[model samples]
Target: DSNFLFLFCYSTYSNKVFSVTFLSLAVAVIIPLFGAIILLKCPIDPQPISFKEPPVLTGPLEPNFKLRQAERLFENQLVGPESIANIGDVLFTGTADGKILKIENGEIHTLARLGHGPCTGREDEPTCGRPLGIRVGPKNTLFVADAYYGIFEINPVSGEVIPLVSSKTPIEGKNLSFINDLTLTRDGRKIYFTDSSSKWHRKDYSLLIMEASDDGRLFEYDRVTKEVKVLMGGLRFANGVQLSPSEDFVLVAETTMARIRRYYVSGLMKGGEDMFVENMPGFPDNIRLSSSGGYWVAMSAIRANPGFSMMDFLSEKPWIKRIIFKLLSQETVIKFVPKYSLLVELSDTGSYRRSFHDPNGMVASYISEAHEHNGHLYLGSFRSPFICRLNLKDV
Candidate 1:
């Protein structure tokens, strides 16, 4: 009886162990299989990107902690000052909450609101209206580019807001999706702007970068005739627009391509397109004409490793991007990117002059535009709560 009992107990223990191991094995296999199936069926049809080898950081492109010396203005009081424009001494910027603000004498005032009320949080950006780029136009009017809305003209003193362009306005049978930045002609008669993408909204910018689609375009709007003309198309994530010092050509930042493109407007090369700069070490955002004869380009992020960055890795692998988009939300994916701040100065000929870096983003991150005014560089960001200010003499 004792021998029989011992054998029965041993057999029961063996069966239990086998069942546990089998269940573990089945779970491991099924989970991966299900994941693979989901990844294969991911909805995003990411196009494979052929990126040029990023330029190595050396000489003027070398990294430095110079940006760490910047001082935060209105820290924790403002949110997402994406672009900066100044009228004399007073400063103007557009914030994430759909408001155009005027900063004067260290005081913040709401000059105009783009969207209607009840903007509770970031999720309401589409409805709340996110204003990206702001420029001072004729008669001290503020021209704003709202990502969700279109272009707006505001009188700073009267607080009067007028709609210049509507997002619903179709160009070439396709509506403008993401209206990013704008620059006014010397006489403020023509407004040159960028449409970032037709497929993605401003909030889905991460997905746009990951997809690397060439749906972006550059446009010119006649303030008098109310006519819009497409100057250039097939841009990959066009972010910034600036007129040359002589107004002979326009420079547009192709963010995903890490380059700036030149489109001749009123010269012998009219209607001609050429590369202004290429293979930048970081992704360029809003570009502004420097006080000198150069341009200030704010880099949203930098490639910590030249050829092995997360962007570089995903550039050639569409399937990997598909899998990542399938498993993670856009916000989460953006958060995974390493933080770094950079601003570069390029000569009018597109030659690199110098760069400022906050290698670890200790003071500022996600700098979208660097506006040079009155011996100071006013830094704008799409993520930070405040703007940064750096005296030019300090650098």
Candidate 2:
């Protein structure tokens, strides 16, 4: 009897120990899992992607490897030259380091610095400076869109920078953030720009793209009234803006959607937006008017292989996407990095004319905007440390 009682007591104790150990292990694993979920705070309201049509593939006449032969102008001197403005023989651009630089007489000069600190990397963006969009207006005023500093007008010749609008300017009771690209009306009375993501700052652009949130907005600032109006909202990562040659419409690049949206500025369709182009071969960044009577649309990277289907598959599974956010790094999660360079030419009617691809990314990759000036294509990139120049006539 004594031996049986002892055996029973030992069995009970061992079972309790096993149960406690299992429970502790489960808690240890689950606590961090839950913590990560809250920390990510992924708010992805994914839009439906209709794959009824895909962007046209490269044609026989399309310049594929030709872009690889481009000359690296201003080599390694600039960082993230996002957009360009040309005046006479001078080319002005905004760099990732928050400085407006101009290249004249084959020499690069600092026109103006938006921030006071030295831009060592993206982490110092707030102190260092990051200018994204640049446009030249009447009287030689350069309109600049600083990702962190709102909008400013600078005199390129005098190196004088004047703050015109703050990124925090409220529209319909909401404050603006991530003021990205800007375009001036033909009359120069108003400035149209895109707030890339109201939810994410410029540093967290990868997060914004991965989350695929519709937090992007478009606005217009009146030079005379000194008022800002939200022209359109709920854009999925609006990046670039350009007015039509006739000023009748404006094209806004929806980066996440990989297409362009046209907003009618004048005419019966004024105040309305339509899908200008859909299912682009790659993610389009900036659209600029070309002297050749077409538009130069820059694609940051070509969506290839698994990337094309992965985004579609993940967009539907927010739960899985949250896990991906928790597990993957920005460089690993974002597929639209500096893998390929694609420049697309489109007519005023939004028809595809031709495409130029540098599959190897030898000369330029991650292009943000390509402006054609004086028979040459001046390329801007959000990832490259140099601006690219390609002779269009030779191609």
Where model 2 places Cα greater than 4 Å from the true spot, the runs are: 1-53, 56-63, 305-309, 334-338
Q: State the lDDT of candidate 1 residue by residue for 58-91, as single tens digits.
A: 8998888899999999998889999999998999
Candidate 2 per-residue C-alpha lDDT over 243-351 given as tens digits, one digit per residue, 9 for 90 to 100? 9888888899998778899898889999998998887777788889877677889986665543354554555566776666676766677653447788888887788
**Reference-based TM-score, model 1:** 0.92
The count of backbone overlaps in candidate 1 is 0
lDDT of 2 at 78: 79
RMSD of 2: 5.9
Task: Write down the TM-score of every candidate.
Answer: 0.92, 0.85
Residue pairs in collision within model 1:
none
Best lDDT among the predictions, by candidate number: 1
Cα displacement (Å) at residue 138, model 1? 2.8
Compared with the true structure, all predictions reach lDDT values of: 0.89, 0.81
